[model samples]
Target: MVSSGGAAGTSATAAGAAAAAAHSYKQLKEEFVSNLSGGSVTEIAQVCAVAPVVSLLWSVLQARQSFFEPYTPLAFIVDFLLNVGALLLSVTLYSNAPLLLNLLLLTVATFIYLIPADPSIRRKKAKLPPNASSKPSPAGSSPPLGVLSTKPFLTNYRGNMLVVTCICILAVDFRLFPRRFAKVETWGTSLMDMGVGSFVYSAGIVASRPLLKEKAEGKTSPLSTRLVRSFRHSIPLLVLGVVRLLSVKGLDYAEHVTEYGVHWNFFFTLGFLPPFVALFQSALKLVPSYAALAVLLSVGYQVLLEYTELKAFILVGARDNLVSMNREGIFSFLGYLAIFLAGQDAGMFVLPRALPSRFGLSKRYTMLANMAAWTLGWWGLYFLVTNYRVGFGLSVSRRLANLPYVLWVVAFNSGLLFAFALADVVLFPGFYGATDARVEKDMYETATSKVLKAYNRNGLAVFLLANLLTGLVNMTVPTLHVGAVTTVGILGLYMVTLTGVAVGLDVYNVTIKL
Candidate 1:
């Protein structure tokens, strides 16, 4: 399901002396990220396999809330280092052989999952809640282990994706980080391109439950009320955006302005998008299908690109007006909005039935299988066939966030969500698909799960720290000149810092909301 793109690097910018003086530091690093073609879907898909594969390994090895849980620091270190450590390597050193490594790991995990283990190895260890039984299951029988539910998987996914984005944001400044993994200039994808869309898509996934609930209840708020609530939720983001803009300008930071724009950043895009969705959703909710709504928006945007001047406007070096100055960020808004809607649609399908509902194993199995089917069906048949045979053969562009890009993000995220869902089914042996959150009495939590949930719970704080640290690193170190070995070491240390802080927060029961 790989997409075809224009050249390796393409963006619109003017390299004038005034602009050059205003952005003097780390010019090489700026060029390093500019106008690069990205990795293929096949390669990205291979990289994504590690998380699901590792989750299985955790299950087969009984790392789930086992005696290892007693050794808190050691368990967290072992679990996180193995999981994120492997991820770091794939996107850096072993990127060339991601498929082979992932396949080998998957094979080992599969064997361990299927073969019976020595009783000693399989013994259960997670401490149950006070009201729940702590006694071990009878010998020779599979414990009524954790019941598979969607919440834990969703939590882990959100955290993992956030961490991945954070990793790329910092790593891209270094030479060892693959250019193919960097954000594309005009049209194409790389891991970084996927990362940005994933952020927007994830927000949609969380937003959908509430958005749809409102629809189900036939509830509508006044435009002013909607704006107030949405802006309240988005203020931190807007403040962060303003701070970033000011900081970059004040420091004369070497920024690839074309990425967002001369005056825009991701924080602004994130802040602006949710409120736009809120104001417009009253009209959009009138249509029942989010997928349909996404298609309408994407196709309409594509029409503007083809028939109007929007595409040319974004691709040109026009700084004559405010709209032209922030063209990439502004023009791409509709595309992102479509991606958000698509994510919401996916949420509608995968979100388990309401709490305390009588969802059964059959339903869970069907739900997970449906995710797999959609991922496979769209990836193998719909995405590929349409990309190759459809109108004008549009390439996936994070800059444009056009039709092809929206579809790609939706398909890509569906695959990741499916992987997380599949992990629950395989790891939590006895009960599958039961929506009762409390059904996890016998289920053991893996360090990866706990750590990731911690990050998700304190996402805004983590993101701020990452941005601050990334800036510090780029300022103090000559990142563009770092050797591969040194680059890897630096990235490793960065990951350790992030993982440790997140784990500490989790350990201390810290929940910092934006």
Candidate 2:
């Protein structure tokens, strides 16, 4: 009665898992050794396998000095490698070790990295006296414009840092976060899903801002008047009605709607971001930075372990609501907002310096760098995620947001942005060349410019559309499949549809370049 077939299948699965784990382990070791010192022969060989990519990024970084001014290709390479290494280590540590142990390790690593080695280390690296500049201002007490300018380099670097942070967040999600994050059916799932959709759409609005301007005044077209009334008025009602109908139909009869209702979508999240950003912008302007921080502190007060549990208990006490709404709605949501604001402020710093004439880097090289970073980021994410299959059980759920996962998510998000930026360059060549205040002039560069301009030239619309469609797909599709053939068939169909839409839109001049 001993079944040879059963034994073989088990052995195969185990072997596959072991092989995956070993590959990941090898990758981690090579990347770590390469980065810490000069890579060994084996490490170099592994890196060389991806050298075409690495060389491209290095060249691109050198060429795109305007966007990457004050940073060298070497810096990006180092950071990219570090990001990949961190993602791998985090996945390995989380999947194989106890949660508490890994968390402690992460805490230690972050603290050590963030904290200065010397307690009394001074940040000021300047050798010149504050007033030593030859061109003194009327207000002699004020620092010189160019010399004391934190506006260009500081803000630009921080913006780059934010990009890196976003990339890290992506890595975590793809690699480790999903394992620990609550399953799709977990508490607050519906609200969270909706919130995410709203946030994504709202964020898109921010991207769209550059595309929308008054013809006469050239000021950003104020949509707050229409959008505030429409979104605030409609979305809630829509959600409520949909939820109520599902409740009435009963679960057995309307299982799909009921389950989908629980999940939040990216479109909803992006839709809300712009108005929120606008509101926050005005609020921050009125208050001093310290005062703003104070407000943030107060709002963030309910985020502590005790307070969060108590608040959740009170809000969803008896209702079958997601329990972790407090965490999602408040803590993580605020973090996202902070990241967004940081990015916004950073744009101001980068835009001034990223003027076309100032962009001295060769375009081809810049594109190459972007491609390399994009590729490596994806590659790193791939390893981080697949490593889990081998026994390193990294989980990015609510209960266990491991540090490695955090880093991965941040990296992934940044990598996406960079890749998109590169795509934009290809589609809308010279799009960012215009420095004039006119949005029309700033929108296009090529003969196909009209088509690109017509399509959500703001870049936000594309993201919103994509997010909405993706979310809808996630909601409706039976994501689970038994075999490769079925999965491939479904994916192929989806891609075909997407391609058809793209081609149709292009023919109609509705397509954006990217």
TM-score against truth, every candidate: 0.84, 0.39
lDDT of 1 by residue, 313-416 (tens): 88886788887899888888888888888787778776644323233535556778678877785465336524656535667778988888888888888888
Q: Tell me how candidate 1 scores on lDDT.
A: 0.73
RMSD of each: 9.8, 17.8
CA lDDT of each prediction against the hidden true structure:
0.73, 0.34
Clashes of each: 3, 62
Compared with the true structure, model 2 gives a TM-score of: 0.39
Candidate 2 per-residue lDDT, tens place, 1-514, comes to: 6599989999999999987865565444223212111112222222211212222332233223221223355543343443232323322233233344335544544454454433222221122111222223245444422211112112112222222222222222222322222123322111122222223322332332242222123544355754564366346434644554454344222122112233322233333444566556545446653224323532353244234564344334353565332233323333344334433432332233132232465543354364455447534643564356753443322112122222233333344344434434442333333223232122322112111122223233333343344434433543332243443344334433433343346457563422
Off by over 4 Å in 1: 1-25, 63-68, 118-150, 212-224, 354-361, 376-386, 389-392, 429-448
